[model samples]
Target: MHKEGKVVPLAAATDRGARTPLPCLPVLLLQVRDKAALQLRQGLQALFDNADDTLFEMADKAADRFDQHLYFEAMRDLRLKRKSIERGFLDIFYDTFARIGQVDPLGFMAANEPSRNKAQMERAASVEGMVARVLSRDGLALDQLSLRLQTLLECTLAPQHNPLGPAALSGYFLQAGRNLGVGLRVKLILLKLFERYVLRDIDVLYGEANQLLAAAGVLAELPPAPRRRAEDRRNDSRRISATLEPDDIGADSVGQAFFASIQGLLAPARGRIAPRLHAVATAQPIGTADLLRLLSHLQHYVPAAQEEDDFDLGQQLEQLLLRVSVRSGTRRRIATADEDMINLVGLLFDHIHADDNLPHSLRTLIVRLHIPLLKVALLDKGLFSRASHPARRLLNEIGAAAIGWETGSEGLRDSLHLRVERIIQRLLNDFTEDASLFAELLEDFLAFSQDERRRNELLEQRTRDAEEGRVRALQARQQVQQALNQRLRGRVLPQVVVQMLVQSWSQVLLLAWLKQGEGSPAWRNALATMDTLLASILPQRDPQALLQHVPGLLKALREGLASVALDSTATRDFFQQLELLHLRACAGAEGPAEVAEVLVAEDIVLAIAEESACAPLRQPDEHAAQLRAVQRLRIGAWVEVLDDDEPLRCKLVARVDSSDRLVFANRTGLKVREWTAQGLAQALRLGEVRLLDDGLLFERALESVLDGLRQQQVH
Candidate 1:
């Protein structure tokens, strides 16, 4: 059967097979009306199943709708009905009338009046006439004046398309007229009444209903009813008209009866959400998924204008839902931090949204902070309730400062976002129970943001100072290196000794040089002394003997610095570093204790060549000495193989043969020579060769050579 524009399939039909098939439209209409009325009663009974006396009284008045004017008059007579009808049942009545081709009866009535613009003015004149008549009498009841004024305001402000019409203006005058005879207190009372009833917008009234339901933990249960198609409603109207004569059934009665029926349909469905939510919130534990579902249901009620104060109340309930809906493994009780975070978020949400004065761009930026704020709350529950907490104050300060922020300031907005993100990251990484841990950092950041010009000036100054300091340190380092190199010229030294001196003393020399002015004579003398001492130390034939000189060199370094007139503070620091280096080198040696003891006991070790008087005390077997020399060879160690001509300084590149013979490379790791350890030892015994411990100097020098070899092999 075609109901609305679409054909009603048998399965989709709301009512079917309830009675015998009928050919007559009137009989079918009677049956449908009886069924609809029965359903309506059932719906009403279910709706008021748990209702209180006040709700029952409301339901009783609401069910009486046989006569249209009488229903309105009955409602007007009841004080509670006036308030409750507007908030609760007015929408329902509008829906019923709209379904039957009437759109906003009150609006239609005012619009259809003769002289539409002057209708409210005429009404106000009539009300003023009555009020004036009452006042002229020797004794006049204040109630009469109050009632007349209220009627005038309602007529003036009653939901009209043109609220600025003459009627509304006259109503305003009538309201002010109440104070003519009454004292100031009664005037205030009349003003409050007008504001409370006449001036209140319908949206606010609906929001209040939503808020109350939310507070009672039943908002999720009462989802908005599904609207029927206009065509289907027209068909229903046609059926009602066909079934009953105009005198037999009034349109007002049908509408009132239809409202009761809707209540029944809504009752069964409304209970579903509230019971489930109550069960989860209070009865049993809920998982994240369940909580998310509940949030989904409640999200329908969260008004789009979330910046409003009442919207925050909804958010608070959402946060509470999240708090109670703990994941498994949690302690079950909500944390103090969580409560603090919820409260803080609520405050920020209200503050940002309520501030319509803020620039749109800045308001947008602040609104984006909600997610991060929520994350912080979830991670650390203590953020919710604390007023003076650092994180809490920081967020509040950001919002407060952002209010005066201008549009087009992307840099400032980005910086603020970055700072908030950084704080969030810190909270996530280090979840401290104490809120004061971030106090200093937050305070400094807040101070930095508060003063714009000073902050920029300070930042620029620091940047310039940092660059200057870097250049100064670099120049000092170069000067120290140049002085050492100049003093070491023409002095024959082992490559290993030169490299070690450079590695250990480079930083120390740079620091010492930095302490004095450029080209200072005293600093030059210190560098010259250091160079002479390093050049005098000869390469020991024994690698172990080379290790023994480290402690003595460290000691001489301290003495030389103390004797020189340099910055004492810088000198002491450099000396301490050298001492630490000595300890590390000694530890690396792993040699006999006698070697360390000898180095410690002797304040100085004189440079002794291999050909000196102490050279040949007791020579080991030639083969054994050669084996010892081969054993001491490290892959990257530098060595000198003495020929009849000039000596060759080369790095030990690789072991070519399994015996003591090895391949040697120059500083670039390119094969320069290859020979047995026995040949090198013989040269060493003859004072023509020496082993050099140059540390990683040769290894770094061979980087390019190794890369070249790798490329060649790849080809």
Candidate 2:
């Protein structure tokens, strides 16, 4: 526990190396603190209260005994210690507010930072991302609240010391859970619950705090936070700083750090391409602008898709350099920074072309944009640093749309294929010094893609729904057949009765299973009726005993047939035959010619065929590894299925649990294929199927380039 009268450290040190003491918080400020603590107590109560049931549900669904025990134990531990955890949380919250003026917020921040263990860093990054999302989503209310709090405190309070910010709430939660006995996964689960149940609606927390402080005569009419450049703001949001180490330059500024990373990656390649002609007499270095001008001139001359291989940027630059030397009697070389941009852009484009995730047509189009993209990078280094740069985003968007694209017979006429081609052409013909063209083209492409996406999503949803319905019906039919076989497989029954149960009663069972689910009253009643009808038709020790059930059995049969909407003539005929059989059983005489058989060969074979349509073709023992690989694939993953030599791209849209069938759809959401788990495994083993990576294009390229460079160094 914190001491009652301890002072919080100052954010800034005094000249004498002593900290400057802050004034006591105003009474109104103290009131605001109490009010926030009360609201927070309620939110925390909701978080922990819901956590118990969430943990219990997880325990019920646990895959194994150990996971089950872990969840159960966590639930019990949380239940017993929950009240104390809340108390501890509130105590820390109150203590933080009490010392809000005396303590240095940055010191608290540093102290709270998790150590560099990979798991800890990941968890911290997750929480940090949550905080960022909250800030972005609720910036206005938070700003007003911050102003009011600062006004009440008579000083600028750091965000970490705001008492009700996500950072503070997250900090309190982490500390409270620090002593819990749960594993990392459970802790993460609880953290997600905290975010969902608490932070999900945290705007209310800020609004309440702001109102209370404002009512107490704090700043009530605060202006909005000053706006920054939209590009800068976008870049800020895309920063990869959450995973940065404390000492990394990225912790300060993302752009510079990203630049440093690129430089490091490109270190080995620098000056290696079209080496500087320092030995030439009167060799002069060109300005970046002049180099960009040379590139722009070549950008217009980008070869067609057929001739891309023959067009080499390095050789062309060399030829241009030689021409400059002959014409002006002076050799010109690109500056170091300009040369670095040239090499980096070249590497990135090379990676893009080689990325198997993208289609050949799209890759060629993207490669054609290389010169224009390089110009953007040369003009605004943000293209290399910021993932959201318009030029970069345009490429990524194209890559995203092209993930499931195929080179069908439609060739260039495919709408999406055509749209992408048009976009690339526009960039080639229109883009010059105006980088805004990237943004403009990006906007237009996004609009066009959005329209296509909406239509595809609708089709995709319909496809998924249809596939799910088919699976459900298949499962229900199989179940009904199993039920019939269980009761009638070995018994000799009258042919007409057997036909009634097989053809009519089976429909009733399927309807029950589909509409009401297995084990439901409707399903159980249907099964019970079938059993009664079958027993009534067989010989009995006391024929009169069977007579008593005849009326009830007939009523039930009619009801079951009605539920399935069976044909009236068929129903009437089946009932008449059933009645005659009952009468014969009562007279202790043989019924109409029995089928003299049990299982219907045709029906059983049909069921098997229907089921085998989704059944795996591979033997478990022979292809266990491939089967495991197929099982690991999840829905929403894209894959390529090759027929002959042609590639068909589709996504795994749904998995039918009943048959282990995976349903795949093309980009427009039309069902393209279905496979049983074993069948897919066999296909994968035969190299007829391949998984496609659907990650962001630029990011993937960047990672690939870096990995290749790193490996090159190692070798």
What's the TM-score of every candidate structure?
A: 0.18, 0.62
> Once superposed on the true structure, which residue ranges of model 2 sit more than 4 Å away at CA?
1-253, 260-281, 307-309, 326-328, 540-547, 590-617, 621-631
Q: Provide the RMSD of all predictions against the true structure, rounded to 1 decimal.
A: 39.7, 16.6
Count of residue pairs whose backbone atoms collide, per candidate:
17, 5
Candidate topping TM-score: 2
Report the lDDT tens digits of candidate 1 across residue range 227-306.
33545434443343333223321223332343333333233223222233343443443443343344334433433322
Worst 10 residues of 1 by lDDT: 597-606
lDDT of 2 at 544: 77
> Per-residue error at 54 for model 1, in Å?
50
Decoy 1 TM-score against native? 0.18
lDDT of 1: 0.40
Q: lDDT by residue for model 2 over 210-304, one digit each (tens)?
A: 67666555675665443445465344433422222122221214444566666766777766655656455567878878777788788778887
> How accurate locally, in lDDT, is each candidate?
0.40, 0.73
Query: 290, model 2: CA deviation in Å?
Result: 0.9
